[model samples]
Target chain A: MAYSIPTRQSTADIIFAQLRKEIMSLDLLPGTKLSEAEVAAKFGVSRQPVREALNLLSSESLVEIQPQKATRVGRFSMRRIEAARFARRAIEIEVLKNASENWSDVYAPSFARCLDAQRRAVAEQDTHSFQTLDEEFHALMADVAKAPFAFQQIKSHKSYIDRICALSLKDAAEMAVLVRDHEALLTHLAAQDATGAEAALRIHLSRIEKTIAAVHHANAEYFND
Target chain B: MAYSIPTRQSTADIIFAQLRKEIMSLDLLPGTKLSEAEVAAKFGVSRQPVREALNLLSSESLVEIQPQKATRVGRFSMRRIEAARFARRAIEIEVLKNASENWSDVYAPSFARCLDAQRRAVAEQDTHSFQTLDEEFHALMADVAKAPFAFQQIKSHKSYIDRICALSLKDAAEMAVLVRDHEALLTHLAAQDATGAEAALRIHLSRIEKTIAAVHHANAEYFND
Candidate 1:
């Protein structure tokens, strides 16, 4: 289901959203300490809102809050990272299968358009835009399959993967590979080859597995076994 | 990943967990209004903690919050229910496949024990226990497959489905059917029949689809299109 439009967000929500983005983008790197008073001052809000925001983030494992101890950005747990990958792969493969079965001329243009945007994003070295487009490309498959809700699980699990990917984004060559994989996946989908589409998707996702070690080594302090 | 053991919980966390259980169990039916002040009074705490709890629940879509308006238990959106079902089925089927392939003598007894618990729960007419056992049975499969993380997605999605199931617990006969399904699934797993296990799991999940129309009709006010 889609997020309900908030007519007016509470101060806590505003802070939570901002902090969540920062944490996910690694702007607030893992192991960074967060204090309610300091964060509240930075946001020009009271500590109450900041506390609430941290509490929410803690629930999602984005931050670790210890009783009577300083709160810190959560360490990257490999267990969680692996779990996220497994969940995303399972859900996306099913979504691709459905999209393949439902392939139609009507779905072709949108898929083509997303790939075009991906190429532009890569050429322009716009990692942020490319990341957004990457998500949209997969999400579009769910939409085309008439099961847009499948993207919720995909997005949820992707948060963990995205953080790791953010650390690996320096490899621009990977962007080209991702786009190529997407194109191959789309080709299979257009051909109504469910099995081929799943194979292509598996290859696309496996890139993350291959890069995990390098990313972890580069950001050693951020990870936990 | 497993939840970190909390050394101590704040007042807010305690209240939040309790309220979350109540909401998911359908004790707080859809459309029931919740007030920060009233909840605080009931819990003998300040309004701050209650407000925080509501915010957390809102994030989970367990409650609907509006500025300057009453927060209410979230309506059962058919779309969300369908999505949760789709996600859980996909993940569980995959987990069953793995469990079948990895079937060891050690895994058999646990499945058999869980099924025994299910039978006892049904015979005793303990719907709550039956529900818990039902979850455990599926979660056990993921554990057996060494894909324990899959249970996280399954449990997340099951929250939405459980609320719907709570309303249909009156049909004691359905519990028996669920146990039978589990028995057949365990038989397939014991035989190391991945395909058979997946087929049995599909049949088990499909029961929910068959009940949706009847449950929605019976609890008309709790659902939304």
Candidate 2:
């Protein structure tokens, strides 16, 4: 069920999407000050739409709105990142379990195609493409499980950890390990082994524990709490 | 791990919160046209804040914004609601399992107190308070499981079903059944029975299936899909 209605984006909507992508991809680092006037000038829109965009970001906790002061990209919090991982693990585990039980031969080709794309991404050392495919991998599991909204919720939680995950994905070795994990998960699903797939997913998601620690150790200033 | 930072609410934030509550409570029924000019006049603010509020609501799918046409409260979609329930169940079942395993005598009083409040709400015929306490019941389970973010995610999904749930809660008999389900769930948690508690939760959340069908039958015009 596609819940998205095809409505045209307002100026504010476009600005919000662009800023959200930048923030999530770490093109805009945490604690970076955002001036409404500057953003308006850059986007060639009035300050009203910029302010609206900032309000939207503030609601998502992507930015902090300090009245009478400046708005800054929200800093990372270890607590939030861990909490998000915990929540994502719960839903994705369920998704994997269902996908394993409901596995069919039809999905094997796409699963294998995605794996090949991941290998290519790692070989090319294209971190951005790897990250996008990584998301698509998990989303594919949700599709196999026929639980589209599970992936939507996972995406919502993913934002909290994207900065750290992006930093982790920069390492080619880490990308290789993730691809192997995805391969293992797909193998389990293809075999209709629910327990094996669930276990494989747990190991896959736990890679973040080390990544979070390494990312935070290297960039402590970007985080709060 | 309180992720919420206490920033002062802007005019738009206040209006957003108020309108969100109205929409979720079904006070501002589905398909009700919302006018920026009138809402601005009513709130004694410029249209910018009202538009911002509406935009925020639109982001949550609580409102549908048609650029040239009128913006109206979003009609309920059975597909989205079911998807929301599926996502909510996945996280919540895990929460209940953890709460059962981590059950301690210390939290029993609070759990019992919440159940008592639910009974009182039903007896007093206070559907609104009952709903609020029902949320608190789940939040308490999250605390017991030490998974606060899980409850936050559940609440996010809950908003997708709140309008229908609110309608269902209007019946005293239905409210009584829900209270009893809560009681059974609490009993299993108190006993530290993970399997039992998980089963109880599955039964508890499944009540929405019947409620959705009945609510949609009676209020067919309020739904889009």
Candidate 3:
């Protein structure tokens, strides 16, 4: 008890979070079966907490739990991925446009830090860590726009995108290209070039969408028809 | 089996659909405890169907489930509603702007129908039906944009917003102003007035924010603090 999993977080919270981290990091690949009994035994709890955790994850579209069926990591949906990408691209470009128009000097350092983390993630060849930082980088853009929650829709969409990326094991060069896109976006934002930022960000997301679809089709077995 | 419900749509579907309708209409108010035993009895089924129904609702953020405690209709949250509205506005306006750029003569009829329904809703003093039509009206914008999923996100967020509105009960006059705004938006979209439509839509969402906040304060008990 000297070193607990931090104070006051319920077993459900702990279970939900641990499972989410695994899902996001691709430690739990799409379509991976989530056995309630196994999860309960591993977490030193009963089936109820595991069920609740799975329910919460299901809300995030991270898991699929069916009545009288085994719980599993969620299936891939090309339509949904495409749909999420469209929404993310549309909204992100808008946010970039806003930040480009209203770039306060305050967000500059965090933006730089985000870029650097991606760089390090690449150098270390850590796709897992790189993906997390990639999310943070997008979040930093929302911060620059002073509309942090504006990215919530995109964030949800991004996880779906992440699932595809995880299954594909995208090339490091593509990751480098993404970093470059972020770099270009930062430059345009720094210069307050609203139209230019929008254009650049649009191109970036379009490329991601193309690559994502290719990845999905390449592993059609992993996807839901 | 004189008449059959599709297996894809089962008892769980019936219970979920019925409960969702009640919640949306505010016939089942926020904080109202949902006893599976009672709900099952009313539906002339066993508790298993009701339990699955509640789980489905819980995943959709329409019901609250507490471990070892009773489940209930979730309370409205000003924070969640405002957050939802922000997202709806952000996404819907972008789709509206897109629609203006590519005027779809096909969806014009749908848009007209939404307006016609709104008029009926007001005349009949059916706020609940009005809200459903309001959703269709916005979904029409996405149809016009060829970005149907954007409407999907808006629809997901609308449930949260509806819970707040059920508390506020904004007057019929308020509904009229929104209808007028929709008409203006429709006019602008028809004319392909991107800038004007975006401006009007922004103002429309801003008014919703103010009115919804006023209602939140006036009836604090209806929401989850």
Chain A TM-score per candidate?
0.92, 0.90, 0.82
lDDT of 2: 0.87
Candidate 1 vs candidate 2: the TM-score winner is: 1
Name model 2 segments beyond 4 Å from true.
A1-8, B1-8
True contacts kept of each: 0.69, 0.72, 0.38
Candidate 3 docking category?
acceptable
Report the poorest 10 consecutive residues by lDDT, candidate 3 chain A: A1-10
Q: Residue B54: error of model 3 in Å? A: 4.9
**DockQ of candidate 1 (2 decimals):** 0.65
CA lDDT for candidate 1: 0.87
Tens-digit lDDT track for model 1 on A98-182?
Answer: 8888889888888889999999988988888888899999889999788998998899889877887777754568899999999
> Comparing only chain A of model 2 with the true chain A, what is the TM-score?
0.90
lDDT of 2 by residue, A121-166 (tens): 9999998899889999989999999888889889988868876667
Please give, for residues B86-111, the per-residue lDDT of candidate 3 as tens digits: 67776787798789988967778888
DockQ of each: 0.65, 0.64, 0.40
**Model 1 TM-score, 2 decimals:** 0.92
Show where candidate 1 strays beyond 4 Å.
A1-6, A123-125, B1-6
Q: How well does each candidate superpose onto the true structure, as a TM-score?
A: 0.92, 0.91, 0.81
Kindly give the stretch of ten consecutive residues in candidate 1 chain A with the minimal lDDT sum: A163-172
Categorize the docking of model 1.
medium
